[model samples]
Target: MKENIHPDYQPVVFMDSTTGFKFLSGSTKKTQETVEWEDGNTYPLIRVEISSDSHPFYTGRQKFTQADGRVDRFNKKYGLADENAEK
Candidate 1:
């Protein structure tokens, strides 16, 4: 509860470099850049490499390989499918 001991926590604008997505949030990090927000006010601007707007996981762009299909392919490659069927 000491005064003047905590860093400034203020509204800042974070912009995604790839997707050009911008959001306003409170952050203690300081930046020299400023951007005017929709509220007609300027805030510190921070550029980020990736954000939820452009992330593969969030954007549903991630590739998911089916394990069952892979196993079937491997079995066919080594002719194991026929051996299992005979057993």
Candidate 2:
């Protein structure tokens, strides 16, 4: 409620490189990079590696792995398994 006490809130563009998804939203984070949007307007551009578009959960490309096998492999490599203990 104070005057000039809050940081500037402006529109920002977050770009996901994996899916080429560009999203415009408001942010208070500071950045030095800028880019011209499709509408002939310039906004702050933030580059990211992943977003909902390319994420496994949202895109339904989730991978299933055998965790037990991974544990066995890790134990074999590091000699962490107890040889005297029952399996």
Say which candidate scores most in TM-score: 2
TM-score for all models, in order of appearance:
0.70, 0.73
Give a tens-digit lDDT track for model 1, residues 1-87.
999999989999999999999999999998899999999999999999999999998999997777677778888788775545655
Clashing residue pairs, backbone N/CA/C < 3 A, model 2: none
Off by over 4 Å in 1: 63-87
* Clashing pairs in model 1, backbone N/Cα/C closer than 3 A: none
Q: Lowest summed-lDDT stretch of 10 residues in model 1?
A: 78-87
* lDDT (Cα, 0-100) at 50 in candidate 2: 96
